[model samples]
Structures are given as structure tokens and as C-alpha cells.
Target: MTTPLNCIIVDDEAGAHLVLDHYLKSFSSLTLSASFYNAIEAMEYIHSHPVDLIFLDINMPGVSGMDMLEAMPDPPLVVLTTAYSEYALQSYRYQVVDYLVKPIDLPRFTAAIHKVFRRYRPLTPAQQEGNTAAPPPSSLMLKVDGEVIRVQLDSIMHIQSWGNYVKVYTEQQVYLSPVTTTEIEQKLDKLGFKRIHKSYIISLQHIQKITHGEVHLNSGVILPVGNTYRRDLMEYFR
Candidate 1:
């Protein structure tokens, strides 16, 4: 039997809880362990309970979601849900699995859950029992020069947005695709890529070093880490 992941909701608003509870019912792999209206109570419950995931809200009356994360020496997989988009980059400081804006739809929520699943279960139960080996690396289908092309996730070093188009830097070559950075960010977030700047998204594995506000990729490419995103970028390495 597949082991179900235990999840908890920590949102102050009643409507927020209702929405998440309704959405969660669709996913059988996860079980709702508890719900808390305040960060203090939630923190207390977490101390005594075994929680695998947290659906946290950023704005609360007394204690915020980011505050709770800061207090915990070690935290469970976090998915931040808020009405504001400005908090999106800052929430990554806790290494959250995903940052979801308010009024989240089923499709986006489903994607976030799948990302959590991949992180929680790097190996299947059967693989843990020595039944099979790991799967192959994943790839992304991208439209480049009016043609759809297959790009290996591991081969990508960085991606830079050029107005409506994006330049994907890989080990072999650079592919210019007519896709927005926001669109590609959704696809790459599940993997180990991060949007460290409005115009730049980089593979975490390809980072050689960070110095003075610049990120040096393993391919000898240097990119500026935007001031707004610098905190989250530094938090990633920590």
C-alpha cells in the first residue's frame, strides 16, 4: 500500500480553510491531519504531531506564516498561500515547495501537490523494497523557432527572458523560445530551478558561486540576482 502523506492547514480565514479542504478531498494520496486558525496554535500542534506538509497563509492577525517558518529550526514541506503576489519571492527563504496566490484553482493546486509528492517520494515503495531502479531524468517540451523541441532538464544551465521570448541555456546550445518567463517558471518550479531575477531563471545545480549580487553558473555565465529576489536566492544556498 502507498503511504499517505499527512497534511495540515494553517490559515486564519475560514474561507481559505474551506477552499483548501474542498480541494484536498480530490487528492487521495494525502490525508488532512489538522487545521489551525493561528500560527501559535499551529506551531504548538506541529511540535507534537508528525506533519509532512503545511498549507500556510502569509497574513494573519498576530503571527504570520513566514514568522512561524523563521522560528522553527526544521520545518516540514511548506506551500505558502496568500492573496498578495509581492510575498512570492520572499517566501522562498524557507525553501517552500510552492508559493500560491489567493483564489487558487484546481489545476495549479494539483501541480503543487505533485511537486510535493516528487520530493516526498524520491523512490517508490516498490523501489524501496528493491523491486526496481530509479527512473530516467525528465525533459521539457518547448516551442522554439516555430518547432517543438525536447530539452533535458539536467542539461539546462539557465534561462533569460527577452521580452516575449526566452533564451534557454543548456550544455550543448542556447534555444530561443517564444515563451514568457512566468510560463516557464511554472514548469520549472517543480524541478530545481528558481527565478532569481525578473529576467533570469537558473538551475540550482548549475550554480558555481554567488558574489556581490551576481550568480556565476557552472557554464561560465554570470547573471545578476535582482535586489528583490536576493534574499530568497541567499536563503536557497543556506
Candidate 2:
């Protein structure tokens, strides 16, 4: 029995909800736990109930989706939906799983759900008493097929974005995980991993050389630093 992800739709627009609801039905691993036309109603429900994911809109009636998200002391995994592409960078700053523009397509929405499902989840009741679901890693988790296995933070050398999937290069092995670069960036940003390119995120500690807009890792791998990210990368290195 696979654990289903409990998710809720928090968009005021009925049409948005309708589209999302239809797309969500295709995944057996997801459960539409609830739906709210306003943030206030969603707020009340979230306080008492634990949900794994949220499909939030940028603009809502009064409180606004961003407002509620900012107010929440600890918000759930969020996938921001909006009609504006200009807010994409700002949305990622909020550590959202993915930001989807309005009139969400099935392929993109499915990718977002895969991000949430591939994310590390809490232990089952059986695991609390030691049923051997595998002990938690010091910092990172790797998704292998349907299971999310554990990996230490230091073992990660670099990560490459492969369309809807990411390849995690660790000290011992390279793992192919079903998640996006943005999702991996959010997960590893604070852990000393930095996104040097749109397609590459590298471990700062593993850098053997960083010059000519390229980073060489101790593992004998070289990754290109994106022009848009070079300034930030330089700032981090300094």
C-alpha cells in the first residue's frame, strides 16, 4: 500500500480548480483532501489538519495567496499557480515546489505532483516503532523508482537537471530522481549546494576549481556556470 499524498486546491477561480481536479485524478498516489475558494477557509483547515501539499494561487480575494503563505509559520509544500510569468523568480524565492502559469497543462501539473511525491516524507506509524523503512539520512534523500532512499549531504557532488528528472552525483553513486532542478535547488540551497546554472546545481565543498565561468569538482566533473547565476555564484564564493 503506497502512502497517498494529501493535497488541497486553494485557488479562488472555479475554472482553475476544475482543471486541477481533473488532472489530479490520473495519479493514484495523490488524494484531493480538500478544496478552498479562499485562503481563510484553507487557513482554518490547515491549522488542525496536516496536509502534504498545496496548490496555491498568487492572487486571491483579500488575503492573497502570497500573504497567507508568508503569514504561515510553517506552510505545506506549495506549488504556486498564477497567470503571470513575471512572478516566477519571486515565487521560487518562497521555496515553492513549482510555479505554473494559468491554464495549467496536464504535463506540467503532473511534473509538479511528481516533485511533491518524490520529496522526503514523514515516517509511517510502523517505522516509528522500527519497522525498517530505513533510517533518515543526515541531510538528503534520493528517489529511486517509487521509493525515496536516504543519502548524506556531503556525499552529493553535483546535480544535473534532465527535463522532468534530476541526476544526483554522489561520492559513491549517481542516482536518477524524478524531480526538477528547481525542486532540488530548494531542497539543497541551505545545505551548501548552489545552483550554478539552469541545468546544474553543485556542491560548494566539492569544488576543485572555479574559473572561466566553469566549476571543476573533486570528482573530476566540470559544470558550466550560467551567466544569469554567475554573479550569485561569485558572491557565494567570496
Candidate 3:
């Protein structure tokens, strides 16, 4: 069997530790080495032991997570955990692998672990021998609910403007991202997506039929095609 990755959790909340303990069992490749309630103890332990990954909480009583990161000259791979999305952009300064919002679900937790493995996992000889032919899937990074998450482009079925936020519809979940529809339209227009109305954008690959100023998606979602956009949208069919 391949060696397991030694990971540690540094969070003051007892609930957080419990949640992690439950999730870690599902990943046999990861082993929890230690759990510290504060950054100081966690830092001292890291100085003396070999740690592969850290699930660090940003807010603490005295020493914050950022302070601990500043003290380490060469820290191991880190995944920042926080309850606020405002710190999302700031966390990127430390080059963390992923920023997970509090009350993290199993799918999100699993996604973060997979990202860690992608960054540190060793490649087999077969992989090293030019076996790479397929390109990586295109994805979009969006800030949602105080966390920056990656959503695969192809998985997106449609987007609907909701006040200051936009609801991103996918096969599994709908993400309410704090991004303007205009901003998202600019980013997705050239990538197999088109703005069908003032409030909606549909994925070209998901379109099943278009009739009478309405675009029908394969997922059974029907969105009205705005008068201003209908002529431009019909260009694709012609």
C-alpha cells in the first residue's frame, strides 16, 4: 500500500475536530497525526515533527492562522478553514492549496483533499512515460458564501441573476455566487455559453431546443429568450 499522508487539524472548535475526524475515516490515504486547539501548540509540534498537511482555522483567541503562517519560513501544504468569505482573497497571499468555508460538507472536504493530492501526489512510471494526452477540464473560480470554489464549466447548466448574486445551476448543486451577471457573461461568452436574456445565461452544450423565443435546456429548464438577444442567439442555428 502507498504511504498515508500525515495531516493535522488546528482549530479551537470541538465540533470542527469532530467533523474532521468523521471525514478523515473516509480517506484511507490520510492519517491524522495530531489535533491542536491553537496555533502556538500546533507550530511547536510542527517544528519537532514531520507534517504533510494542515487544516488551519483562521480565527483564534491570541495567535491567528495568518500569524502562524508568517512565522513558518517553509511551511507544509496548507488548507485554510474559516467561517467568513471576506478572508478568502487574503488567504491566497499565503498560497494555500484551498480555502474551505466553515460547516464544510463532505463533497467540499473531498474536493480539497483531492486538490492536495494533485499538488503533492507522486506520478507512477507509466504516467511519467508521456501517458498524458487528454487536457484538463476548464473550470471557473467564484466566490460563494465566503469561500472561493472551483466549478467545472461543463457541469454548469445555466446561470440566473439574483439581485447582487447569481445562481449557478449545475447537475448536483446550485451555487449562489456574489458575482454580477455581466461579469460572468464576459467570462463565459467565448467558452460555449451565451447570454439568452437580461437575467439568464445558458450553456450551449446543454441546449435541447429553441422555439417561440424560449430556449429549452436538456435538464428541463426553460428560459425565455429576450427580444434583444433572440436575433443574436439565432445566429448559432443559422
Candidate 4:
């Protein structure tokens, strides 16, 4: 049998805790290790325990989720939780496994967890050394309106979520489709699209300038840089 993914929840809200608890119980592959109301308590728990994953909340009273991530000596795979869509782009810079908006539903939540398992599961020594056989390529075709648009993996710039739909921004134009941000994020994640804010995903190549808390695209679109994402972006610069 596959090992159950050890997980924890770190959020200040009581509702969030109860909701996450309910969702976690529904997943057979997941095992809850602990839950904390603040980052400090979570940090203490993690220091003395082993965890495979973390469901982290972005906005907190003190020592925000982003700050806690930055201070970790060795961080586990992270899935950011936030109500605001603006923090989506920033979370990608930290190499977070996924991002989930407020009031997360079961279907969306399960998909995010699956993505983490697909990407980070341990590989054998041979596989790690690239001696094992390669996996098949994963591709996604986007349909904009009635036109079938084949977006080659190399051409996508980023994806943004607006209400119930997602706007996939590319070098040429944007493709609006009826999909959740989390759903689109999983599809484009393997191709290098990083969630940098709650509503924006950026192509790392199209980034012209990153200053203050904004990412200036070559197309002149300025995207906000979240406080949590700033450090990771700086590391990429180095």
C-alpha cells in the first residue's frame, strides 16, 4: 500500500480549521498530524515531529504564513490557503505545491492534493539518477469560446482567476475559460507557470522587472508581489 501523506493545518480561523478537518477526513490517502491556530504553534510542532505536507494560510494576525515559510530550515511541501485572489502569483515563487482559495470545495481540494502527490513522491535511486524510463508527456488543450486553441506548453505566459472562470494569458492574447484557478493551475504547473498572486500566474521568462511588490511584464502589465513571495523571487534573481 502507498504511504499516507502526513499533513497539518495552520490557520487562525476556527471555521477554517473545522472545514479543513472535514475535508481531510474525506481523503483516504491523507493522515492528519496536527492543527494549529498560529504559525508559532505549528512551527513548534513541526520542529519535534515529521510532516509531509502543510496547509498554510496566507493572512494571519502575526507571523504571517509567508513569514513562517521563509523561516523554516527545511520546509515540507506547501499548499497556500487564502481568501484573496491577489496572492496567487506570489505563492508560485516559493515553489508551493498548490494554492487554494477560501471556502475550498471537496473536488478542488482533492485535485490539489493529487497534484502534490504526482510531483513530489519519492523516486528510487535509479530514477533519481535518470536511469529509469521516462514518463509520458502531459498536455492540455484550451478552448476559447468556440475556437479550439492548442496552447503548446512553451507558449503560455500565465493564468489568472476571475470569479468562476480563468483567464489564461499568453504572449499573444488571453483565453478565458470556465474553470477554477486551482484547476487551471494544476494543468499548467508542470510547464513552468507559477502562481505569484491570488489571481495571477506569471511566465518566468516574460518577467521584465520585479520591484517593490510588483512584477512588471514585458507587456507592461504590473503584477503585485506578495510579501511572502518577495524572498523567493530574490533568490531566483541570484
Cα error of candidate 1 at position 60, Å: 0.5
C-alpha lDDT values of all predictions: 0.86, 0.82, 0.87, 0.78
How much RMSD separates candidate 2 from the native structure? Answer: 16.6
lDDT of 4 by residue, 106-213 (tens): 899989988888867665777768945555333345545533345655566667788998887777777897768877777666465677887877878788888878
Model 3 misplaced regions, further than 4 Å: 121-238
- Candidate 2 residues lying further than 4 Å off, grouped into runs, are 124-238
- 1-238: candidate 1 lDDT, tens digit per residue: 2677899999999999999999999988889999999887686577568899999999987668887787676789999999999998888878999999989999999999988977774456667789455444377766665344568899999999999999999999999987799988987775889998999999999999999999999989999999999999898778
- Those runs of model 1 whose alpha carbons end farther than 4 Å from true positions after fitting are 121-238
Ranking by lDDT: 3, 1, 2, 4
Q: Model 3 reaches what TM-score against the true structure? A: 0.51
Better of 3 and 4 by lDDT: 3
Q: In model 1, which range of ten residues has the least summed lDDT?
A: 131-140
Q: Which of the two, 1 or 3, has more lDDT?
A: 3
lDDT of 1 at 139: 74
What does candidate 3's lDDT look like per residue over 1-238, in tens digits? 2888899999999999999889999999999999999887687578568799999999987778887787675688999988888888988888899999999999999999999998885558788677566443387766665444668899999999999999999988999987799988877857899998999999999999999989999999999999999999999879
How many steric clashes between backbone atoms does each model show?
0, 0, 1, 16
Best by the TM-score measure: 2
In candidate 2, what are the lDDT values of residues 20-85, reduced to their tens digit? 999989989888999999876686577558798899998876667877776665678999998888
